[model samples]
Target: MVFFMNIRHLPSVFFLWLSISLLSLGGCAQWRPTTQDSVKPASTGDACEPGVINLNRVTGLSQIIPELKKARAVVVGESHTYYHHHLAQLEVIKRLAAENPHLAIGLEMFQQPFQPFLDEYIAGDMDETTLLEKTEYFKRWKYDYRLYAPILRYAREHRIPLIALNIDRDITTRAGEVGIGALNDRDKSHIPAHMDRDVPGYEERIHPIFDQHAGSSKRSFEHFMDVQLLWDEGMAERAAEYLNQHPESAMVILAGAGHVAYRTGIPARLQRRIPGKIVTILSSDGIKLEPGVSDYVMFPAEKQLPKAGMMGIFLEQKDQSVAAVGFSDESSGKQAGIKKGDRFDRINGRKIREIADIRLAMWNRKPGDVVDVTVLRKGKPISVKVTLK
Candidate 1:
């Protein structure tokens, strides 16, 4: 059994509760599934039959029902930018809440600073519109309010404890600037033991995603790993605290897919501290496990949207030298004869693959840079000299 600590705060209690929830959710045990444990046996064609107890697969609400019964906590992995994933998570939460009266839903969106606002909304101290305006990121992520409206509504109507589990973005940015290793021992003391060591195959799993944002100055895989570890450690501790306070209730954590996986992730770190706590990974596709740690792995019978745009585009190796000509104030790309899908072979003798490189070359230059942009126009290479903006 996982032991949780009870700590109360004033109006600021919301932040404390949110932090506690994050820590608890991050602490799932690591486990892997075998070929025999996969969904292949239970799935028929591309989908599973409704009302069947497919332990190897979670095709519909019926399959998820049984899994929800056994675990004290459920962690749903999501692609943050995908509106569909958010919708699916809300559906699962609604089903779980209905099935079990004493259920709490945790979110990765709300940070410690925004906890008071969340508390006010949940406590009916503020109106829905005010709360929504306060949490603009939730609205701006996809410019769709409907994505988050359901969860907020459910939490308010049901009086369910909506736990906020994300660290402040500013803190994350600062951590990124100063490498995790650069942090003093005292500062790094909060990190979990599992995170101290490099797990085999962990880098391999992360590299593919990291390579996608290879050129961005703000995108650092190491920084991401560091912030993730810190967030997971904080979340695990908080979850234990929440469980301590509400032993009768079951919790569900909604976070990015990368943080919820059983091996070399928040779940594994959590399992290290708490034994016998059943950790499950929920994804749109079949759940990938880390051998012997997770008791059950479940995937929803839903199609997942592609992961792009929020992090930016990932160019294929062949499309490396690609140039996307978006209108710069609706003038250059359109009026100056630049079109979309134009391949930029070179810019003033500097071979370019990504848009970042082109921007860097143009930065801080005089009005007339005399930069020659070589474009592959209709299978014919053409050089056009354009002045810097």
Candidate 2:
């Protein structure tokens, strides 16, 4: 659940999400994976073209569906903010379902505590707002929900099992702040011992990145590594556990690309615990995707179009209205005088209560368009005009 950053960018990469506080505050940075950070490089391998797949003990590049069916678990990695990547993932799921209908989707976004919410949501017993709020989606995962809608819609339509496969963030944060020594007997119960399996390749890449950034640091790089492994192992263990419980079902595990890239994060850890065929697929995203980095790389063969535009504001359902919690300072929302803590009442004359409503309203809006917004500021309703940048 880490932000995908191209290390080649260096100091400029820090500008994407890194603030002065992030470099200074150790606990805040490691505890939350929301902010941008160094992405580990792929393990040793030669360069391969987009369509080719460097799979486990395989020879040459392979087609998507054929190779997907061959695995007991196919871990597809995603950058939470990348909307198109999730569409690519949905395409994979659609193709895989044709071969095996008894499919399960394991998620890294939702914590283990909210397994019931996922169950209920998948059962079609709850609404989207309830599901998001109950799972603490706003608190834990701040990415746009629209990016995940396709997968969720597919799962619900088919009534496929959705497995929640990560431990609570608080426990993971504790492991990152202090080593595993800080975990009490209760915390130990949440994660199994097998999560400590060797991922030497991951260590190779993450170590240098951590060292490069963590100059004169008080905390050890190994501590950060421990937290990541804790995350990887917990997810892998839970996925294995689900497979063990539902032997007939094969899974398409959705997680951050870092978790499965080069097979160092989850695939290897899961293999150490339970021996079975596992594969990874990730987005090329115009980056130099090294060979053997993943079983398959997904993107347009010719080119990738830039993502669509919108008012750069992070919203959450607040009481009867949607509240703004974050904003892209350079975006139009800032220029239009929309501030944090503003509760939405109307947008372009349509009542707005959820994020989907805003997306629907903005469907026809272009980059330089102005957005008419009404908000409740300081308990008084007010109107604000925002230009979408």
Q: In candidate 1, what are the lDDT values of residues 1-389, reduced to their tens digit?
A: 11111222111101011111112122233223421223322223433232222122113345446656556677766656556566667776787888788888767766655767888888878876566556544322323344466678878888888776665566555677686677667555544344543655565666776677657444477786677667776565555556657878777777777767544555655455453344444443433322332333333234443321121222223456665545445343343455666676776676677554443343324443456677777777877766544
Model 1 misses residue 131 by how many Å? 2.3
In terms of TM-score, how similar is model 1 to the real structure?
Answer: 0.55
For each candidate, the alpha-carbon lDDT, in order, equals: 0.54, 0.70
RMSD versus native structure for model 2: 11.9
On residues 281-330, what C-alpha lDDT tens digit does candidate 2 reach at each position?
77766334543466555542222334456788888987777998998767
- Candidate 1 runs further than 4 Å off: 1-59, 133-145, 181-196, 215-221, 285-389
Clashes of each: 19, 0
Compute the lDDT of residue 310 as modeled in candidate 2: 73
